[model samples]
Target: MPIDTTPNAAIQRSLRQCLSNAAFMLYQQGHVLETITIPFRGLDGSALRQLREASREWPACQQVLESSEAAVYNEHGRFVLTAMGRELLFDMFGQGAADCA
Candidate 1:
């Protein structure tokens, strides 16, 4: 389905949910290499794409970049979670699992 462009409360909530989903997806995959722009597959892309589609709803999600090796993007493509991103992901998954249990 095409994402709604019109701004509303639902869009705001979906945007936040998408961010949380993306963060959790990345965190579950764990920090492997050091690259923000790694070639992601599976759920990772879905999570990110969902957020991307809702970019207009939340601009903050755009700031959340993947961490990489050498402290910057380089030819050695490998991606890891940033310190802040990891913390956010941890909190998101932790709370989610706790709530489910």
Candidate 2:
């Protein structure tokens, strides 16, 4: 068998999935993932940290959000999803059972 040379690709896919899931959860609750505080008590600390890190480094995800002005840091230094973010969440997770209300 050949060596797995696509570790970063796999990680990126997983990161996108995780971030999409987190965004959907927040959308359902009319909230957004914030850096200043943990959005969900049940969310794994490491996963949350990874999501935050991806928000800064992931070009596809971060660039889209930033270009659309969807992801923004509030005055208190917390990352909150804007209205456009909700729309982007819908695109990422699909118009599934997650209510983006």
Candidate 3:
């Protein structure tokens, strides 16, 4: 199914249902998967995290930039924003993650 980026609740629901069913079918086939937030362009977590605490959610949230290089964090509950994300926030709001309350 085609994706509708418009802010329509019905369209969003349909897209979500489609994705959910696909994932469920995969799980039923014994191919379970977990969600992992990743950096844009598959950047290095070390390089990106240094720009900010990119592993803020490292404990509870799974973040994977590359399967070859992974940072194992033993904590959670904090939020992290990638360098690109920080730049976007700065460009959009004149505020980086550090400036946010």
Top of the candidates by TM-score: 2
lDDT scores of the candidates, listed in order: 0.39, 0.49, 0.33
Measured by lDDT, the strongest candidate is 2
Q: What are the runs in model 3 whose C-alpha is more than 4 Å off?
A: 1-7, 35-101
Per-candidate alpha-carbon RMSD to the true structure: 11.4, 10.0, 14.9
Backbone clashes in model 3: 0
Q: Work out candidate 2's RMSD over C-alphas.
A: 10.0
lDDT of 2: 0.49
Residue 75 shift from truth in candidate 3, angstroms = 30
Clash pairs, model 1 backbone = 33-79, 34-68, 34-69, 34-78, 35-68, 35-78, 35-79
In candidate 1, what are the lDDT values of residues 1-101, reduced to their tens digit?
Answer: 88666755565455446446544444554522222323231224444455456545323444434211111222333233434444434455563322122
Clashes of each: 7, 0, 0
TM-score of 3: 0.26
TM-score of each: 0.29, 0.36, 0.26
Clashing pairs in 2: none
